[model samples]
Target: MSSNTFKQAAEAARSKTSAMNKQSSEAVSAVKNDFLHTPVMRAALPFINGGISGMVATIVIQPIDMIKVRLQLAGEGGTTGPRPSPLSVTKDIIAQGKALDLYTGLSAGLLRQAVYTTARLGFFDTFLKGLSARAKAKGRDVTFVERASAGLAAGGIAAFIGNPADLALIRMQSDGLKPVAERKNYKSVIDALSSIVKSEGVTALWSGATPTVARAMALNVGQLAFFSEAKAQLKAHTQWSPLSQTLTASAIAGFFASFLSLPFDFVKTRLQKQHRGPDGKLPYRSMTDCFIKVAKQEGLTRFYRGFGTYYMRIAPHAMVTLIVVDYLGWLTQ
Candidate 1:
């Protein structure tokens, strides 16, 4: 009697445990299904994927970006200043501090990508779908002009929204150029942002918004529009695999992006890096002013001073970001 009772109790316990496990699994599955099927969640996936992809790419490319910024800012006031190569900039950064100095504004860079890429890529995808649908309704394919317009619009909107983070990134990266005593020594992106808002105004957070937006528009047109175009062309004309097509498309996009945006990017860095002097006057008044002054004084080529480094930074970043985004989209699909 005792043995049977004990066995019965053990069996009941096992049965209850199994039931609980089954219930938990069902519950998890239900939740996953809801997440996948919910309109809001589905709508938000592109932005989430874009941010994650951009952050991953930024982590890999931050050092190169740092060097690129340094190169752009090297001969600031005049064309006769030292011409620093990427190698020289890398060495100098290491000499000044450590290898990690090459990632001086990483927090700001990540923040910038999180906001900027999320919005731009999400908007681009959304716009592309709408355009494709319309074109399909008319029994036609999406045109390059339509793609470029979508990219430009997405970039402009995203840049405006992400200006604060972009400003903080430029400030942090350029801080090391200041005297040790003058450096704010921002501990993080938040610190840099708060400091800027405290010393300057909220408006100052968008110090280079004009150039930033312009650069973003140029970049998006080159990167997004050209990538789509290249991929379409490759698919239609070549016998390349999907991976080959993507890689080649991304490379083409990166070059166009770097070339088209460098001038605006150069202006953006300078404008964002500037602060009011003792007289409360900033160096450059606006995007146009900066462009003019730089062209007049520093020579027009100053805008393209770091083309090679910029290309290296932009190309790899574009490749990694697009690849990761594509993979993520595939997974989600």
Candidate 2:
């Protein structure tokens, strides 16, 4: 009687286990089919979503970005004249004009994000997918370095293409530190580009292309590679919610990006705002020359003069943009 009961119980347990496995496999297959059918995963959706997310983030961070640029352009030696802090810059900008003047280059910023962020993010995703597929086919996993390279390449290309908008942004922000009479008073990003082309030639639009592209490459590294790694690590090791994980990863990525790119940004701003004289001669001969002049006159610290303001701008912008992107993706699913 005991042996018969034991055999019956074992047989029932095996059958139950087999049925559960079958049900689990079916559920997984259903989810996979649904994912494949979703339009959000289409090739071009990343670019569209990336642009929307970037524009939204840019709008929210525009003020901070203005303050950062002002701080970057303030003072000669990073401490020579009356030193300008973020609060002082904000006060000056608001005191001089409408409080909204703090968003002087909103149009250009949005346009730049639309062009730069869309391409950088979209290209990276496309390259990543291709690499991942190949790796999977070959029975291997994609490496972090490969992903970082993709981010770098995408950013460089996008930044170069979007240099006109970027140059306009710097020019608009540069006016904040100038007397009203001397200011260009660009009406919009379009006006700024037209004026530059008319007065300075179309090539002037890409005045700071070198440093801008470099900054973009570094930013991509931070925003994509570092953020991806951080997020993956957070998910694997922590019990944090999706929002927390994104915020934490974005913060870390933003800091890295800002730190790596600020020096290049300072140079980009300086170069973009410079104009040739009557003789078609410019103050700075090249990126290296500008770096030397600023370093000699403003000191080495000038390159990082706006660290706090930049971090303030970059971190929240990165976090919000990524969060929005993730939210949109999740909603689609």
Candidate 3:
């Protein structure tokens, strides 16, 4: 009786384990097949890829962005003198505290990228895909003009949606450049948002919306258009590897992006930080006034204040983002 009972129990357990394993394997295979084959899965891939790549790029580049903002804000002291170079700004920042101080507004930067970059890149890809499909149906291919238009529209919309985060970012970055007593001392992205809302009201969050949106449109047009065309050109005319192609395209994209958007970016930062004087008058009435005054008073070069640092930040981020996006898409598909 004991031998028969023990043998039967062992046999039952083995059968149950084998059946469970088979079911699990089938489920895994089904999931893998659907992810590889489904249209819906493919469609959502761009958004996921773009969002993740953007956040990753933002993390890598936030310090340079913070330094760029500080360089621009450090100009307040330079009005009667020559503007400080990026190296001087970096040294000054390091002198103020630890090297990591250069990443003071990192949280805001991440939030901005999560909202702005994600939306802009995702929407551009989505729009591009739609246009490509339609064009293909007509026995045509998507044009560069079409790509630029998609990028511009996507960027403008995303910038508007991300304005609050962008304003918070500028404030947080510039706040550290202020006198200790005058600093708002934002604790984090949420703290900055809440403080701005409490002190200034909802509309204040969008104070520089015009310039912000303009900068984004310019940036998208430069980055997206240049990258696409440059990559295609490299592919068609040369035998560059994928890595070489991405790096070259990204550098070209970054150059144009920094050049076209720096002016608007400068204005946007100033406008976002502008406040009503004790006399109830704001420094600049609008974007045009800000641009004019900056050019006249600070000189035209103020618009390109930190071009080297900006290029460093923009180029690496663009390359990382594009490469990651491509890699993720291939892995997923």
Candidate 4:
């Protein structure tokens, strides 16, 4: 061929290659859109599942959570009486108030789970989709790490937003000594929130923010990373439907995440309880002090107080939350 003809041929080949590359990129984009879209269509399932599961799990584990909080809040050997083990705490409640005590704060716990879990799951998915879209617009692929980072951010933000409800839930669960008159004063969630803010000040609502943030960060990391990985692995090995896969993966993720963050949770619960000294300020003063004091008085094992309950609550909570969220997204689509 002539030199001009050869140059034209080379240019044609280059143009064809560019067109093929564009097509491949579009195909990848289409696949990602499908993946994201599937979840959105079934979004209602996740909300329902998460709400129900979280409420049930919280009720089942509230007593152990109560014990955990009590152990955490107890001053250095300043208990009302002998300390009870996790198992004994339940027995004590049963002996004293029957099943009612164990289910203390059931309403508060249900409200919290309903709000926080829905927000966390909903916002996390929304944020992830936005981030993925942004990445795609920049001609980039969204990595698992990116997804996890988004999840962490979403969790932290959600925790901060829902911190007030969380405080109320904790207070209701652990307020064993407060009189019936005082307890009955706050009728609704808003009433309880208003009462706390008025009596304890707005800052009281965020008493355990440090540990709450830490827990949220850890939880998101575990859920996003582990849940994603588990789903992928399950899909590879089993022919389960999307719902089944989502539920199984979420349960595994929730269990491990809860286990990992149990210590921080223990600390957070301890610090938030009414530990005021004579000056009407918190006795522990800070998260560090709370940790140090608990360690000194109750030993390191105490830091993991109610760990079994933590696992039991978290595993099902996470599983249900994920499954419900995923299913909801599916239904919507």
Candidate 5:
């Protein structure tokens, strides 16, 4: 072929490639637009984004969470038991098995996030919008009480819905505490759920549900409500950038969340970790009973025993989740 013929062929190929690229770009744009513009997707976006964010945060913060749990369970049953530090707990966990042992029950944790975070965030966002609209109609701003109410309602609902997964997570995390011969040795979240159901019935999956719900409500009020309020206040009062505001707000929220929720979380873990004794009786009769017994036997201060570790876990998790959710919302918008 002559030089001109070869040039003409190359030019034609370039044009065709450009055309295909343009078509592909257009298709992607169309799909994105459809998703963003659709009513169903718009409504579901908060839940989806919240779940993804929560899972990502959980993956990063799992080690700290494991340490916190171990720390909480260290002095079980009495005040004169072992007082384990976070470093000690980490070393103990690693010594028992491998580093991955620290990530026990990660499957159940992810599933809990899928249900709990999704529902809590989605409902909070939905309720916030309604509250904002109502306040606007009244020619006023949304009060902190309104924000807290939204968080409480969302957390209670989500915690109840996610109790089974939460229970499985607690059971799996605490399994290693048992004697090797007595361990259930759950292979996965499914295994844990199935084993619990088979051995104790479906309702067993919701063990410690009362404390779980209370913890969720406390956490959400501390986290969601405080985060929103702090961010708003920062935005109004400070010259900080949006990122700075988010970070500060999240840090504040995390501290409050850890502080407010740790007692209930402690009780929840204790309850979920217990099974029927050889005498066919559980340790604590109910949430109230657990609280009373713990205060009487373990001392009131025991509830806050792992505050530092809990803050480390809760703060980082809250920061990551909120930051990711904010980023996702921006991207979707």
Candidate 6:
């Protein structure tokens, strides 16, 4: 063939290949859009599943969590007598109340999880949507940084709003009493707030605000950023079902986040448990004081007394919740 004819033939072949590639891309895009846009019948599945999983996990680990509180309050100087290991603590709780004591605060825990998960997950979706809308109004895209900031803000707000219920739940769990018996009966979340205000004062509701906020920030960032990345990567690289992918990603994120925030949790539990002096004031007084006291009294290792239980509870909780939530969503769809 002549050189000009050969060149024309090559151009024609290239054009055909490009056209095919574009068509293929468009077809894939359509499939994805359809799958995503279809109305899932069980959109509420994730929230319900997440709440149940969290409640169950909390109950299972309640004893260890109780021990963690006791150890945290003992301070850094350490326990006065022989220190009980996690296993010993577990045995003690079982002996004290048997299975019932092991699940001392089951009702409170379930309530807390139901409220917290609902608010946290519900508000997260709402905040992201609001941010997206705001960005669109400004003729801008919501960047990763913006999304992260939104998560932080949303988490903080949710934590604050949910703080009182959390405080009551913790107290009820550690103290194992309804407010009425303690002369601080909180019939509901609002009743708890009012009772605390009437007796301990409004500030009592925010006993461990600092640590709570910090934990919230860590959790939100971990879940939003890590979950998003992990889901994308898993879908792209693996052949796992969506349920498996969601559970694995959520479990990894929850474990790391929960582990990182354990120290703060240790402090928060201590601060919350410490009795007010005869004058009705907090014993530790402040976060710094609590930290110094724990370090000086209990030693560094005390900060991690229930590490194993923490991991066990969080990993399964996250995995189960995320998977169930996704499954519910799929079913509804």
Report how far residue 276 has shifted in candidate 1, in Å.
1.5
The superposed Cα distance between candidate 4 and the true structure at residue 8, in angstroms, equals 75
Worst 10 residues of 4 by lDDT: 71-80
TM-score of 5: 0.94
lDDT of 3 by residue, 184-282 (tens): 989999999999989889899898999999999999999988898889889989999988998899899999988999899888989988778899998
Q: For candidate 4, write residues 1-333 as lDDT tens digits.
A: 799999999999999999999999999988876765675544544445555655665666665566656555544444246655667666766776767666666667778777767667666666777787999999986677877887788778777877788888777766664656645434556776787898879888888988887887788777866797789789989999988888888887887688778878887787766557678777677789878877776678777756666776677667655655565455544
Clashes of each: 0, 0, 0, 21, 0, 22
| Root mean square deviation (Cα) for candidate 5 | 2.2
**lDDT of the structure predicted as candidate 3:** 0.87
For candidate 1, give the lDDT. 0.94
> Tens-digit lDDT track for model 5 on 258-325?
99999999999999988888999999999999999999999999989889889999999999999999
The estimated TM-scores of all candidates read 0.91, 0.85, 0.89, 0.73, 0.94, 0.70
Q: Provide C-alpha RMSD values for all models, in order.
A: 3.4, 9.6, 3.6, 14.2, 2.2, 13.1
Q: lDDT tens digits, residues 1-333, model 1? A: 699999999999999999999999999988887887699877888899999999999999999899988888887888785778889989989999999998999999999999999999999999999999999999999999999999999999999999999999988998998899999999999999999989888988989999999999999999999999999999999999988999999999999999999999999999999888999999999999999999999898889988998999899999999999999998776
Candidate 1 shows a clash count of 0
Q: After superposition, how far is residue 73 of candidate 2 from its true place, in Å?
A: 1.1
- How many times do residue backbones clash in model 3? 0
Quality of model 4 by C-alpha lDDT: 0.71
The lDDT per prediction is 0.94, 0.87, 0.87, 0.71, 0.94, 0.66
Put down candidate 6 lDDT per residue, 253-331, tens digits, no spaces: 7776676777777777777655666897776877888778777776777767677766665666666556655664565
